[model samples]
Target: SLRQDHEVVGVRAGLEEETLGGGGSSQFYDLNVYLNELLCIARLLDQPFQQHFRLLSSSLSSPALVLPGPPKSLARCRAKAQVDYRGMRYPSSAHLLDVVRTTWVVQDEESLLEALELLLASQIPLSSPPSSPLRSSSSPTPSSPSGHTVVRVKNGFRRRGGYRDVKINVVFSSPSGFRVIG
Candidate 1:
């Protein structure tokens, strides 16, 4: 595949046999450049020769977009940013636990339900000394079906219309009482 370009040029000039059989595209060019940059960074850092030697021994592969960031920045924004930094250190030390993931903000009821399901799935059960005590619904409620357990999170929690950053909550459990009441 890399020889396609060579083949075309060779046919036009009547020197098909002498061409190096190289078919380099724009992507191939970009990949070569990216690899060169990566190699240069690794070399300048004074990493062991064997480490650089390994990458040199293998064929170079192209990536769509390769943006490297620092590990400390990544750790701080771990909750918000989804980054694959391979392994690099930053120049600063900062605690960044509270970075909110923009994707978590839901605009509609359908997305709200989806987000609630995802959140509920991630929650661990309350321990013996419960942080918040659970209470049963006074009478029949729409959100909780007859057979299922329910704890009213807060009154007047509407799904539709304009949204705010109110913390809406719900929990569901099995009949055998592997329950998650929040």
Candidate 2:
């Protein structure tokens, strides 16, 4: 089985922030939401994901090269922000993966901070409102903006017990559609 050959290398956590952007919190949330999605994939192969993946080690190397020796090709990936017709924040998980690799890397305190930012970004959407709308609306837009879709911001805070906590706030959108002004 795929899991048998490759140990269920722990899920990749916040890397986007480490390499690119960051959230305004020291504590980061786990991508447990992605776990359900991954587990669902594992179950397809009749495998149980029990093993955990922690950071073995990391340093400022030239990064992994596609081919060995000089003239090596770097595996580069870009993180793009996606916005739905309605404006909503979709955390850039794909960007995080491009940064620190995975969450297991947060062994030390400093790395933890970086991890938190990346993880937070992953949880949220990567998008901003378009400068100009493709089409104009004759009717006045709703106050909420996103309409039925809701936008939530969960803040991650550091605690005394060397752990972090998250608080979530849900905001309903207005009737017309959500707007990403920023």
Among all candidates shown, the one with the greatest TM-score: 1
- TM-score of each model, paired residue for residue: 0.20, 0.19
Task: For candidate 1, list the clashing residue pairs, or say none.
Answer: 2-23, 3-23
Query: lDDT: which candidate is best?
Result: 1
**Total residue pair clashes for candidate 2:** 16
State the displacement of the C-alpha of residue 147, model 1, in Å, after optimal TM-score superposition.
Answer: 27
**What's the number of clashes in each of the models?**
2, 16
In model 1, the worst 10-residue window by lDDT is 2-11
The sequence of per-residue lDDT tens digits that candidate 1 reaches over residues 24-77 is 332232224322332222223222222222332232232112122222222233
Per-candidate alpha-carbon RMSD to the true structure: 28.2, 20.8
The Cα local distance difference test for each model comes to 0.26, 0.25
Give, for candidate 2, the lowest lDDT window spanning 10 residues: 47-56
Q: Candidate 1 at residue 91, lDDT?
A: 7
